[model samples]
Target: MSTTPLEAGIIPLVDAAPLIIAREIGFAEEEGLDLRLHRAPSWSSLRDMLALGQIDAAHMLSAMPVAMALGLGGFAERIDVLSVLSVNGNVIGCSLDLAARMRAAGYGFDFVDATAAGRALIAAAGDTPRIGVPFPFSMHAELLYHWLGALGVQAPQALRVVTVPPPLMAQAMAAGEIDAFCVGAPWGSTAVEDGVGELLLPTTAIRAFAPEKVLAVRHTWAEAEPDLTRRLMRAVWRAGRWLDQEDNCLTASEILARPDYLNVSSEVVERSLTGRLVISPRGDLRSVPNYLVFFRGAAAYPWRSQAALMAHSLAARSGLDRAAAVKAARSIFRTDLYRQNLRDLGAEMPGATDKVEGAMRDPTAVASEAGHLILEPDAFFDGFIFDPTGDE
Candidate 1:
């Protein structure tokens, strides 16, 4: 087997573990692939690097490919989501002063009531607070808008949305640059550790099973090297499965905490891996199952409905044609490619390529090639469901 060298780009976040683990644990080597990982500090830089062919693939935000497909970022080339990397690992954090103000305003930081949190935030800050997100087109931004909008706080008008890199979020908050932030894990934990912020709510409170990050590749590269793509997908899938085991959580965190990787403390990274999050500076802990999902419950499947949901949100926010945006976004998920490449490996993939998003209210058994697959509830907090094929 010839060793094919491939460069993959990633941001320093807990969700980028699968790509790092695959290369570190010999999964890529076993597939006859030599993976070179590149660390990118910001989302736009990583997106541009992937777009300009600076990297073969990347660990990208779930909505990025859809954004590229809709021409939102002015990138000409189309990108494809080969698989999901992580789901529902984001948390909203507010500065210590803002948190104290919210508490004084009769808000309970229970981390379950998103509407109350939003209303309290509005009351305490009075439309003047600046909230930072990792990117404009990320699940962090979408969930923040959805949660606040559901509570009658109009976005970009009632409050400001700012873009800050995830790694720099803690420092930004400490420096009084942003009052609050909705970002992926470890960074939020870092803020809590640094005595700068307190956790307000998890993105799961807005929408459980929110797709967070994906294994993305350029369409041109995927089409030109079909075999290599299959090999890469299989290797990454194996790494994800290895990551799902409870015993491997600490080891995974340690690997991610390396200076060459996330460059954070292993203890902070382990919080997300173990689903035991410290929500406050005073060590208030919460047990959130499936916090940073890698493999269980078809977590890696590239669902078209997920893409369509992102498309609808972006279209509604940006004033684009909903139908056209949904159509273009649906093509980027590449569910057909996922099924074609992973089925032979006996992957427990959903029989249907698309389903009603956020409709399941329980762990229901569904049709699958390899017997039954139990899908967990992905209901929205407002009891809304996204029907990609219907007038949602």
Candidate 2:
């Protein structure tokens, strides 16, 4: 079979596993796609590459396409999120000095309680705590804002938000550029490995099902090349499904650790995959089930609600019209295209395109065409449920 060549941009993080796995494990090849994965230096560069048509698609931050639609990132191009590639894979860590201070202040790094962690961090970190995030328009930023704001930190206003690439997070911490960071694994694990920082909490503790990275493409490209878009989405979806299996963790980690990919140790990558993370240099392990989700519980489904929730936060922060921002953001997540492409492949199609974000607190069955779709817990730590339909 003759395959159509396609290039996709990705940052070197463990969450980029689906795209790498698709190419290495023959999913992309089986779908008649010659997928070329490019490792971008940072999320900003990857976003620009997708916007400028340097790549056909990108493993992007879930909030990126929304931010572009709302005219926040200074990029004029319209990008569509084809699917959610990964979810809740971020870790919030702090420098060794701050960790020591928090511990001295009696804050245990429980790695489960977002409220406790946030309050402790606020108290430990000075009046203007510097926090590093992979990108400004990222779930890491959004999660940090929500987590800190709920704990009375006043968020981005009162805090110093620094933009540091994931791979450089440890270095930034060591150089004292940032007192704390919210980054994707295994970079957060890298900080622990390097003994520069210690993991405080996984972002999942803040928002249980935050969409971390997305499979994104130029809106025009997706519209013009429907067949190719469908093939790529299906290929990546299959890769995510494979990665979701418990037995495939070791192999997936090994593949992701290749030099062409993350280039980190396979063991470090495996920690994120298995959700058994070492939180400190002392080898204190924390078992966080579903810490990083690729395909289970409609993890690949790009729900419009997720985009709206992100838009709601972005608009409030950027002084944009909230309702208009949400309206624009919802269209970027292509639920219709998701159904059109993956319906026949035995992929469970959720009956609803939009739901109340942060409403599900447990693995609850929801309406779906297959009638057996149970969504994972997606509650925010503050118990806030965002109704996308009621945005007005």
Top candidate by TM-score: 2
Query: Tens digit of lDDT per residue, candidate 2, span 293-340?
Result: 999899999999999999999999999999899889999899999999
Candidate 2 C-alpha error for residue 321, in Å: 0.9
Tell me model 2's lDDT, rounded to 2 decimals: 0.91
Cα-based RMSD of candidate 2: 1.0
Per residue, candidate 1 scores C-alpha lDDT tens digits across 94-135 of 999898998987888888877788788888876667899989
For candidate 1, the TM-score is 0.97
lDDT, residue 333, model 2: 96
Provide the overall lDDT of each model, using Cα atoms, as 2-decimal numbers.
0.88, 0.91
Q: Where is the poorest 10-residue window by lDDT in model 2?
A: 383-392
Task: lDDT for model 1, please.
Answer: 0.88
Off-target runs (Cα >4 Å) in candidate 2 are none
